[model samples]
Target: MEDRKLTVRSVERALDILLCFTRNDDLGLTEIAVQIGLHKSTVHRLLSTLEERGFVIRDAATEKYRLGMKIWELSTHLSRSDDPAILLLPAMERVRDHLGETVSLYLREGKERLRIQAVQSNQAIRRVAQVGARLPLYVGASSKVLVAFASTEEQEALLNDPEWPSWIDRVSYMEQLYEIRECGYAMSFEEREPGAAAISVPIANCHGVVTAALSVSGPVNRLSIDTLYEYAPYLMEAAHDMGLMIQ
Candidate 1:
């Protein structure tokens, strides 16, 4: 009976740990402990166990814990769930069909940008994408859009990163972000990867939170800098449609 009671209490505490995370992507040990009214040692032990099982991940730089892809992987298929990745796939396919270029969806994952889904172009020379590919937040057009629309806190965090190029003026980049915010899209040619060009548009939640991005990509010659601008309207339209349905 004592063992049974201990098991019940453990389950309750575990549930409380999971419930401690909602809306926000990350929490530190102190924050979780204070929120759950538990000791720091207990919270650390629980988080350690959860990390071992892939229920959560710790950012090496921030030392904060966020729900892992394992949790996202499980919850994505729940009935009637309106996950943006699921919604973005079909829209991406349409963009590929419209432009005969590759289309992809991205979301900010920590300081890295994650490509969660993509539809490839039919051409032999087109850019190829893997679903789980990650890139730096400040580099590509899709990632730039995500950063531009991010909260001021997040933007500041990324801009202050030590990896920022020395030649690129921070003040100018800040101003450019404002332009991206005003125009509702971002474009790039040979910025991240040589011989590649991309055009991207933002996806905002019902709360006007800019959370994800949709982009079309192709070879630089076929989809030159000028062509990227021409494709912006189509990307914006698809992103706008998806934004309307994001709960």
Candidate 2:
């Protein structure tokens, strides 16, 4: 029992060392030791083990430690897991039930947006979101939200792509993306599909990086632009809840 307790404590200290890099990209051994209230020698030993396991890297010049590629690789696996879908479903359902509209979780796939999960409304005339459906990232509310929060290089790549729809005015769309970023949401009516309307907000991970778009959508007749605006707070709250589950 004593040995098991010691093992757990060591594991906890190692995790603390890794978490120290969350606020600053890189940290010196003394900095980590001070932050976590551990002795320098103990911190060095733990960092050495972490570096060997590929969870941290030491810069030779400054001798500061930063997160290694293995962390990013593990994160990619987590993103691909079913955990996010399962964890976020309840929040999506809450929004769907409250608004009587379909709620969808969209992840960006290159120049397209894929519906990874959805909870459809029970209404007789409701918008149906088919999971695994890939739609262009150039027209709909969710699409715009994804693009708006995407990295600058990603936005430029999509804008310069030859497949960009000719009907979309690049300058105007750029302006809209700016607005979406400033307002923290996006809305569309009869843009992607006629008679369809949607309001979407960005879903950010623990690191504050936008990972997906959460949307509430329905037929235009039932979800007019004004009604969608009123529903924004609910959708935003649900999206924030879902984001908390990403990590």
Candidate 3:
């Protein structure tokens, strides 16, 4: 027998479910059900209702579900509402267009990394990441850029966890942070994923606190270390401009 039962389905639960969608760009029925800890049938029914209400939709081509146009339209109204992505997108677009690669905006959530926005190039071989994707702290160039700026206490805290990712050690991450600060940008070659390379520049608030980062990524073949060095100045320029714009 179930020891406890939910007496009512409140609006808060629905909203919490909606918020989960913001952590991931797309999810299938089973994935959503598992994440929300609900029965598959219940999740399916809720998703159908959400789809009818225009909060979500299923992509026939990929058979995956994602937030719908309505969400995007509604989100646009709040785009500038205390979120850096609003001010970052325009500058990000300029860099993306100039570099012909994928651009992303990232923010730190506690010790994790969150994607605030992403724009994939129209080019055939463009790299892409879901807008709401969350990744471990040591996953990629942008994530490491943010992590490198984290406080020593925070770094120590993460280091104490035995489950931390394999590639990042606290001492090494700290060293890399100093180098990134000295150079004004971060670059990595296939560190996070095979064949993916990226360059990142930190975004700061008016107080000069690092709040977010802007990055451009592409296949390693196309964005070699030498070329990434060549592109570093542009990324720094864009991040600086966007930070001022956000302020």
How does model 2 score by TM-score?
A: 0.67
lDDT tens per residue, model 2, 1-247: 9999999999999999997874578999999999999999999999999999999999999999999999988967774444667788878888877888998999998888988899999999988898868888998999999999998999998998999888889899999999999988999999888899999999998778899999988899988878987888877877887787787
lDDT of 3 by residue, 142-173 (tens): 87788777787877777677778666666777
lDDT of 1 by residue, 166-208 (tens): 7778888888789999998888889989999988999887777
Q: Give the TM-score comparing model 3 with the true structure, all chains together.
A: 0.76
* Model 1 RMSD, rounded to 1 decimal: 8.8
Q: How accurate locally is residue 199 in candidate 1, as Cα lDDT from 0 to 100?
A: 88
How many clashing pairs does model 2 include? 0
Go through the candidates in order and give the clash count of each. Answer: 0, 0, 0
Error of 3 at 93 (Å): 2.1
Q: Return whichever of 1 and 3 wins on TM-score.
A: 3
Pick the winner on lDDT between candidates 1 and 3: 1
Q: Report the poorest 10 consecutive residues by lDDT, candidate 2.
A: 75-84
